[model samples]
Target: MTQSATWDYIRGSDKDGYAIAIATNNTVYESREVDPATALGLTFRHAFSLSDNLLLRSSLSAVHDQTWSRRSDALIWRERLDYDIGPLRLFTSVDTKVTTLNERNIFALGSFLPYPESFVTLSVLPGVLYRLSFGEIGVSLTASRTMFRFETDYLGLRRNNDRVQPNLFASATFWGIKVEGSLSYARVTFPAGDFDNLQRLLYTAKATIPLELFRLPIEKLTLELSSGRTLEDTTLPFSVINVSTLSDARLVAKFNPSHALTVFARRKDDEYVGLGARAVTTSLGAEYAYTFDGGLTAIVAGSWRYTQETGNIPVSSLNLQLGLSKRIDFSRTTTADASRATPAAPTTTR
Candidate 1:
């Protein structure tokens, strides 16, 4: 069994072009296949529009895992500047990220290390994009490096790694469906040079579509479809392999018969090339909520999931949950200004 909870708090007005957000997630896992453990994560994010044409964003996140005595932290900073050149829009983006991890019991010198090991990675990306009538096209160069912080560098271990990639990417929306694609050429080198250097061409493409765009007859029914594929390389870590491939597809549908009743279903499939793994999962769920006079809401929900993985038999499980929730809003809003505020952009999860 796995349980998780998340909390998010945001301050500042979107209309003012500045906002700060703090969030935390806590999770506990109990299973026969692995030891029971708990993990906690915290995140802080801030976004400020320096002007109508420029934006600055920063985020910091940290996670601690009790099962492995592991701690990980990451910081990301980004800036974007836009300019209108006649009918076309040109934009420049700068992004930087630093990630560090510390863990005990790391195997070294043919034995488990008593002290903790630390690893650090840094990445920088600068890109320029041009907006077209339907979509945008951009090119970027990324440089990333990783280092091991230990007493001595392991001889011939190839623990330190570096990569330089030049990529071309584009995205467009057509007929209410958004599509994105990218092509990259990556060169990976090891400081020790004991391992062979790698050079590969990687390509990825993704598409998303919402069924509501078709104006279906069904009321209060919503459906979404999304699929993505990475052909020669993947976004996975380079510590495992220099090149990998991944593919996935997902579909989700929801129906609300009334204000208090809702039903949802999801189907997903995933494949990994370098890992030689494939999985499929499907689930259906429903929820009902009742609001009391005092503003507290009682909720009941149930779901059944079926999963199958490569070289494993299929398994199915059913879950039922009950909860109570109350929401409190501290911000003040007027109807006229609320109506004129732009809607927040939709987010996608993979």
Candidate 2:
């Protein structure tokens, strides 16, 4: 899954040149009849700086598909605010969202199928935020309560949990480069033995150089490099603690060499860096997009992923897909993937 920290600072600005369109495809090759599908989307956004101290934003989107169409059409909405009171100002947001599907009908990175019967999760998190900054120092805090539900994949019973937790973060920016990270501690008490508790801890670090920071017209062309790891309750039998590390390398560059073509590329590499003799599995992927002046767009992309077992047995999946799209601009576009844009603006999604 894509992380939520990427677009926290992008408050929209008003202008005429703010329309966008996108399309995507997924094809899995495993010597079997895997379902294939494509997605198309569009977006428009404008920003108001509100005197450099207060900001407000909103966006809406809809998603429909022929692949796993049974899942449901996705609808998403969001809003955010940032007001500078002095050294610190309070921030807040409201959001509505639904899961979209990948090739195997799965919604995230860890699996390839929908959650089994009786296994479910649904909730909305409204949060309050505080920011602190001075010279080279910066810090932020968000307290949110999640009203969530869960169930077993094999059983037919549902369970729910209501909890509040604080998300703490600290960062520093220097020499046109900024380093940031955050920590979260969650406690879920279920009364029932098997439904009881778990802990998830994560750490992330990112470094980027904005082309504009160095005075370039391409605002989307930024050099970004980052990595993160997670520790969680172990489900492995006889293991003391369960830890998995995913290291990523990503580069997002936007090229508008002329008004006729909008060129972009996204490359990512991640692997299971679990601790063991043969635990270094990896996957690498890249997508190249070309958007014509007439609003027709095409894409060609591919990926390869390999896994090595404890005994060093290796298995892999190789894939390639091509897609075509025609945006009516009149048809409503789903906002699910629009998270690729700031929550305040609709853009391409995961």
Candidate 3:
């Protein structure tokens, strides 16, 4: 069983050219196979609009996890800058994370071994886009490096790893059908150790089609299909759970019968390179949400899924969940109102 809560507060509006936000998330988990655990996260974000066409945003986050009678912590920082001209836009971002793990004994089994006691990873991406009549085309280059030190030899792992990749992507919409595709080449270098330098090419394409385009009665139904390896997220949350690191091809369909309800079905084929395993999963789910007069919102969701994996027995399961979310603005005053209320400086002595 797990219980979670989140609080978020914002002090200003992006339209005002400056804003700040603070948020916290806490979760408690109980399990029969493992000891109880608690996880806490705190984040701060700021946005500055230097000009109408220029923007700068930054965020800092810290996460602490208490489990197995040990505490693990991670700190992350990210910064981004963007500027645009008449038909061109340029942007750059930097992300960094430092993590300290103390759970080596917890995973004594065959589970993928955890990282070194401490590690740091940094990545930078800079890209440019050209707005086209139908959509846009862009190119981006990403470079990242990881460094770590281990007290004892665990898996013959090295202390240094680096990767560089350049990607080309484009998206366009035609007759109610939207399509997108990207191609990238990645080169990775590892210090003389357990692994050798390697290179690979990656590609992904997706398309979304609405039933209305075919004059079908179900105007709210839409289908989407995609295949490819997405960019990796280097955040603490994802890193802790070791999720979303697989490449998959997926097909999904969604239908909305009402303003507050939605239904969806999905099928995905996953490829786990590290484990040399492949799996297929299918699921159906629905979600409903309603807001009260006092601004509080309640949400309920449920799903049933089945999975088949190589060298493992097929399994199926059902899940139900409930959650609550709300956003509060501490600064109710608008920029224009604040400016007007500042009674013009006392008129110069006549």
TM-score of each: 0.64, 0.53, 0.69
Which stretches in model 2 have alpha-carbon errors above 4 Å?
Answer: 1-23, 28-32, 37-56, 61-79, 96-157, 170-173, 191-193, 209-223, 228-245, 251-281, 285-299, 308-314, 321-350
Give per-residue lDDT, candidate 2, residue 346: 20
Model 2, global lDDT: 0.44
Q: What TM-score number comes out for model 2?
A: 0.53
lDDT values for all models: 0.54, 0.44, 0.62
Provide the lowest-lDDT 10-residue window in model 2.
1-10
Candidate 2: tens digits of C-alpha lDDT, residues 1-350: 11110111222233111333333434444445544443434333433466667776555556554342223345556666667676665666665655333222223333333442221223344434444452223333333222223433223322333333345565666677666766656444444433434455656666765556555555466566666655322112122123455555556566552211122222222221223322455667765566666554555556666766555467776656454544443222357645353222222333
lDDT of 1 by residue, 1-350 (tens): 33433344455544232333332233333345534445555666556667665555655665555443344555556655555555455555555555444333224422333444355656677777778889989888878776656523322244566888899999999987888888888887777764457677777777776667666554434333334333221212223232334444444333332235546666665553344566677878776655565445555666778988666799887756555544333334688976785433211111
Worst 10 residues of 3 by lDDT: 341-350
Please estimate how well model 3 matches the true structure, expressed as its whole-model Cα lDDT.
0.62
96 Cα displacement, candidate 2 (Å): 4.4
Tens-digit lDDT track of model 3 for 150-265: 52235444536688989999999999999999899877676654445656677778888766655544435566666675433121211221112223232323232222554666
TM-score, cand. 1: 0.64
| Residue 205 accuracy (lDDT) in model 3 | 81
* Pairs that clash in candidate 3: none
Sorted on TM-score, highest at the top, how do the candidates line up? 3, 1, 2
Candidate No. with top lDDT: 3
